[model samples]
Target chain A: MPEDSKRPDEKNLPRFRPATDILERADGFYLYLDLPGVSRENLVLDVKDAELMVSGRTDYRFEPEERLLESEFGNVEYVCSFTLSDIVDAESVTANLRNGVLEIFIPKTSKTIPRRIQVEYQGE
Target chain B: MVIDFGGFGRPYRLINELWKPSFLSQQSLAYPPLNLSENASAIYVRAEIPGVGPDDLDLVLTEKNLIVKGERRVEKGRYFRQERPAGGFQRMVALSAPVDADNVRALLRDGLLTVVLPKAQPKSPRKILVQHG
Candidate 1:
């Protein structure tokens, strides 16, 4: 289903409380997400308008008939949202998830870049 | 040092001293391994939070500190005895430098949480050109 059509009433839905880092460079920005237990298989990254959506699930439960020893953790899931600023180039955004970390790179718009003015040299 | 109280009057101090090491050991054992570094521009934190999902974690930022809290729910299988403590935990740290709270990011990879905190604008480096005579 499209992320924009997603209403507030989805069950088994991942909850989002974003913890993101923004690294500004001469040309762009890097946004990193701490989404643990999320695999590349279950991870979803979506862009809607100026908002970025990140959601996933972590499955740790085994078969019911299996022998159990210790258990403190329950099922795992993820839900986080980011509202990007105008400086972000939404079209150029790219995301990658490796070893549970989700990294999104957003290149800055041309307007955000500093333009250098040419210096004129007059012949004496 | 050993102090024997009469009959059932065991020295509470003695019990405390004896169990102090044990209690310390349990706490040390329960704590996750963590490493942190900071510079004028940002603070970096890495924590080992294995088998936990994003929903199990919480991140908070205050005036001078950042807190990471979450629960690790270990699954129980059949025919086994449970021993390890599960549920959740929390850790708070005072930052080494003032950060641009508007631009903080966190990533979880391979059971590790990595946070990158950007420093305020004034804390950034200024380029100075040298003029020679």
Candidate 2:
């Protein structure tokens, strides 16, 4: 069925919530999202107003002549967002998509990193 | 972890439930989502599987059923949110009709696994001629 033919209430198709994993390390945080069938061209990643948003669309089309016996693979659009904290340096964040998985690295500022301090005794 | 005891222990159970791995759920353990389509001479089955490589998949085809088995490994990381299940899966799909297993072609692309099974012979509707009395 064509998307436009659907009623207004159904116009917005169901979006798939991609499962994400967030790991906090000493230097920074790493974010991973499982997005199968999504290509690099279809992915959109942006940080606006301290919010990190990731979205993508999967491309799967069926021929008109094909008869569907059973259907479970529906059209899915991936959408997820997270609020970034002050410690995350959004400007220096990097992302890479490989094998249907996306990985984002958010580096922390130098001030947030822990540093060791040494003290010398001055009393005799 | 701090335990909450004010609300009849409901919150604690919820937290404990959330901590469990999602693959333990019955729905996911049953089978992965699949779609089946057929045409005049072939049957096509598509399964939605993300983060699984082609090498990890194992397939067994018979005249009546197609068994798909594979595992999606959990990547090494500290997970803040884990919704997608990571574990082994086995699904045996019953074919509507007998198929030629030798001619079956399977393709995995974009995390969608599609198997095309050709029929032994094309079955076409026959047109019978009307006899005049």
Candidate 3:
């Protein structure tokens, strides 16, 4: 696979940092990224060494006969990264993209979750 | 505003949080960035609107103008970083050429909206050969 088409990483074009929201829960963490114009096939996600990287590219190709009158969006890329803690179980991470938004699930280890400890009636 | 992650402080750090390029900063707030184009037979309009469904969008096309209105709703939750704004927006664009109102088509897929309007009359040009007198 050619290095250019295979990966979402692009250096020559302009890149934008996607607007993001990170929600935390006892069970796991949910990350939402607004990546408009990026298709499912153009998204790239990687988790390595406690770091999560997300990159997406949008392609805007005009036909030969079409003439652009007004322009705002063009060929651009979206990139955002996050640093995960040790408690986060990287192997179980999962993600999905829908309606141009990317959702990532980062589950933590069972030991990290706060739990109620059952105590015997030894005080009685 | 930044929020703490489970009271353990903000574990997630965005390295590029302040690295916004000036060229696109103003364009970001202008919701639903659009592209208007036209060919010999039809006009095209495309808008990038993520997280919005077909029901949330309303489009009105007339002889000389096109109006787009839509709402983008974000789920309520405890957010550590909230950057994507959620609200309703309306934008009106002027059409360069007249179009067939009855034949306009709108399609939504993966958060991109594409509208095609066929021209009122076919503008295919013909070459007339000049004969020697």
Candidate 4:
């Protein structure tokens, strides 16, 4: 059948690495991951043993009778992990997924936050 | 702070190498990955484009080709690792059958852009009946 012929190679489908952007600021770090086709329901983010693990499953599937003319975006699992540093306040880390893009905010620890010191002048 | 790919080690590398052929072929075709499918009466096209809004997309359909153009804007930040490509991209896909451009419908959801193009009516084969003498 033409539909069967167009079926994706599911057996060989590779776990894709989502493109990520990590930015550092004075207060914290911002992580942006491009995860197209992955909805919030399928996404999973966790921190274990000082590692930030991000994984999700995309829900792009074809019908049994549908004929695929071009096959570029295949259904696959997304997996990527990053090691967290001591400077990051793990307790305050927050993440939000919008439009299939996952944004993670890792605030810096108290020691990392810059502090201003007041000076007292002594009269001679 | 440095970010590294943990658990993506030797085994993952081996699997990636095995999958490189297909992946390379797709990358050679267009910027954003696309999927095109067709049924008896309609053709559907989907492109993967995360972080892009509806306002940033421009779609045009002709008799033989469907053109998609869009831009992905990058937020301002100090980068440590920037892998997602940002900028303008355009792609024109040739249709296998004639489509009604005016009836086409497009939807953008969850970072996937899907365009449904209704197919024009095809000429049906006529049957001939044998006459008994």
Candidate 5:
């Protein structure tokens, strides 16, 4: 957003915490992060110490010869982390990046799913 | 200045993260952040909008302004926690130097939209020296 560049210098650009969506279903939990202008080569996805970390650098600067007319955004990093729950299968986790959107699938070990128990009749 | 906690920060270092300025007063933050730059030949306008294809975007070029209108198509159904912005959005960027609208070129890749607008050559009359003969 234009909120990125309040100051003129690129050094003042704040690290943008990308907007994300977390969804839970029967199979697993899903995370969708919006990281624009960040290519796959510049993206980093790490799962360590029971934490899920997603970060990327946006190389938005133009050539040195180009003069900036209006600077709303600049070279800023996008970072966000989440503590993985016990049910999350960190080893089996998979991620995909497409059209600047990062999707992470955190499959559960059949734990997050609710199961119905049938009661037996013991009438005498 | 941005303070980086390295790649992955401490797990407990997320109390103030969820309550971002985006969730509060969204009006202050413009949608689809744009960066405008210019060289001798053309002016470049770059916008970051994920999940939006070229067909979804519409551009209207004027001598002094460029109106960008687009829709970010999103997956249907319901999401337990929805944060990423969806739906239609538009922005108008003012241009200082007149641009050749006919030659403007727009390209979309990896969700980043870059528009190159060639500057129109100045048509002002050239100064002539009038020497007495």
Candidate 6:
């Protein structure tokens, strides 16, 4: 009977820190994730409580019909994940995948948004 | 940016070119590079082809080998920083075990291309008849 086994040092959880650009604006934050070999079908985007998790995989296995001379990183499977903070908007989160890049727009929470509050004058 | 992996005097040399830089290409996307794994059944491979479309890619399997050719074209009307490799890229890999080509599947999402190659069936076992010779 075959069984699933891994080295004790191997971590079962997926770990991904996509290349991101946090442009802090007066309104929101933009996060860009580099996810290649992942399709809309295989990708999972979820926000539980205050945590955000994105996971996907890339499979590149073909039959043995041709001759290969040199191979690069193109044959490995890909899996990655990330965590979100309270400042990130969960309900309004939007993600798009095009040309192998995953771009996510995360607006800031209402409390985190910068606002100009007028201070009342109380001169004693 | 095109990075030629070079070839051994072959007609078509293997190369890697990206017309636009993907989020993964950026220093920020800290995903692990491409990797490989194997089991008694078959071998598996995953490649990160960020910013590359399916039409621009070509996968060729010939004579006990595999070849992946594709181009990463930059989106038109961009000029801030053009560091992405534009044009064409190719990766050649050696096949360690037999594969089921007809049943292979490829899926692309999040700028990544996943190829599934199944292992070939093992040879059938045979019974020996060692009678008094």
Among all candidates shown, the one with the greatest DockQ:
4
Q: Give the better candidate number (1 or 5) by DockQ.
A: 5
What is the TM-score of each predicted model, taking all chains together?
0.40, 0.72, 0.75, 0.80, 0.73, 0.45
Off by over 4 Å in 6: A1-33, A37-95, A103-124, B1-33, B125-133
Instruction: Write the residue-wise lDDT of candidate 4 on B9-126 in tens digits.
Output: 5244224534546545644357677788998878999898888888899998877999999999987878887878899998888899998877999988778889989898877989
Give a tens-digit lDDT track for model 5, residues B85-125.
Answer: 88899999899788888899998876788999999999999
* Best candidate (score: TM-score): 4
Candidate 1 fraction of reference contacts recovered: 0.13
lDDT of 3 at A1: 11
What residue runs in model 5 are displaced by over 4 Å at the alpha carbon?
A1-13, A111-124, B1-28, B124-133
lDDT per residue, candidate 2, A1-124, as tens digits?
A: 2242122234354465676767776667777787877878888999886778888877766645678765544556677777777667878989988667788888886666444578878997
Q: Which ten-residue region of model 1 chain B has the weakest summed lDDT?
A: B1-10
- lDDT tens string, model 1, B1-133? 0111112332322233234343343333443434455555567765657556678889899988888898866432221222233577887777766788999999776676777787777746879999998
Candidate 4 per-residue C-alpha lDDT over A1-124 given as tens digits, one digit per residue, 9 for 90 to 100 = 1222233434444576787898987778999998888889888999987889998877776545668776665666688888987767888889999888999999888876544588999999
State in Å the error of residue A80, model 5.
Answer: 1.4
Cα shift from native, residue A2, model 2 (Å): 9.4
Q: What tens digits encode model 1's per-residue C-alpha lDDT throughout A1-124?
A: 1122122233553343333444554556655555555678777888888778777765432222332222112233556566676766889898887555576777777776455689999999
**What is the Cα-based lDDT of residue B124 in candidate 3?**
82
- In order, the Cα lDDT scores of the candidates are 0.57, 0.70, 0.74, 0.78, 0.73, 0.53
lDDT of 3 by residue, B1-133 (tens): 1122222332222332224353245543477777788998898988988888988999998779999899998765566777776899988778888899999999887778889988898568999999999
Off by over 4 Å in 2: A1-11, A25-27, A114-124, B1-29, B122-133
Candidate 1 residue A50 C-alpha distance from true site, Å: 0.6
- The candidate scoring highest on lDDT is 4
Worst 10 residues of 4 chain A by lDDT: A1-10
RMSD of 6: 14.3
Model 3 off-target regions past 4 Å?
A: A1-11, A113-124, B1-29, B122-133
